[model samples]
Target: MNRLFAATGFVPKKDIRGIILNRWGHAFVTPQPGFFFDTATRTAPRNTVMKGYGRISFGHAELEGFQHWGPAADQGRRAMTQALKNG
Candidate 1:
């Protein structure tokens, strides 16, 4: 499932990809990534300890589905991966 894709703003015409979790305990299944969508996740809330941080994959996430761009985004993902391997 394209969990990362769903994190971005991808309104599916049929089916959504998956769920996305933020720094908080909140879960999102639609477009919730971007600065306008979520800036709070960048900072901590209340008295929480910042013990660890995970650097997400360094690249832009693409929204794939019938509504956003179409299911062909899956093919592009595979092609990109293959190109990376070949190089």
Candidate 2:
């Protein structure tokens, strides 16, 4: 399953900012619902509470493997930095 997803580009080819893999081998595109809500309540204005809040839905279970061993956090950070530098 994981191989299929990777072959089809269903999962992220690599990790990026704000993305993380869960224990179930699924990619969490955004923070969990509760955590997002809590953070929004504390730091975001009411109007913007839903601004950056969203869900992580995937079309393939194979890609879900990313939730377990996707790229490391620092790797994601470096990728973001490199993207910014190149752009």
Candidate 3:
């Protein structure tokens, strides 16, 4: 799926792996390394990497998680930032 399909209320496994396929027609069923949740908002059904989106995967409460679009992008950027800092 496109990054546009990711947002809050999205559980990484269900949202990112169910149907939305990549350009190569590949849907991932596995989580990346360091995939974890904040201890504060552990009140979700599954591994809730998205927390501020609607059923339509829009950023209704995106900033609530310090995330811009969704978990996919947010995590990607976070990792990039960490890598840059380390480099």
lDDT, candidates in the order shown: 0.38, 0.39, 0.42
Clash pairs, candidate 2, are 1-62, 21-67, 22-67, 25-64, 26-67
Candidate 1: how many backbone clashes?
1
Q: Give the TM-score of each candidate.
A: 0.21, 0.22, 0.27
Q: Give the Å shift of residue 33 in candidate 3.
A: 15
Of 2 and 3, the candidate ranking higher by TM-score: 3
Residue lDDT tens for model 3, 8-82? 465667655456545633333343333444456454422353332233222222323433346657655654554
Q: How accurate is candidate 2 locally (lDDT)?
A: 0.39
lDDT of 3: 0.42
Ranking of candidates on TM-score, top first: 3, 2, 1
For residues 1-87, what per-residue lDDT tens digits would candidate 2 score against the true structure? 456576666555453335555654433444343432336336423223323223311132122223332434444454455455555
lDDT of 1 by residue, 8-47 (tens): 7655754656658666433322433342222555532211
What are the runs in model 2 whose C-alpha is more than 4 Å off?
1-22, 27-71
| Better model by lDDT: candidate 1 vs candidate 3 | 3
At residue 44, what lDDT does model 2 achieve? 29
lDDT: worst 10-residue window of model 2: 56-65
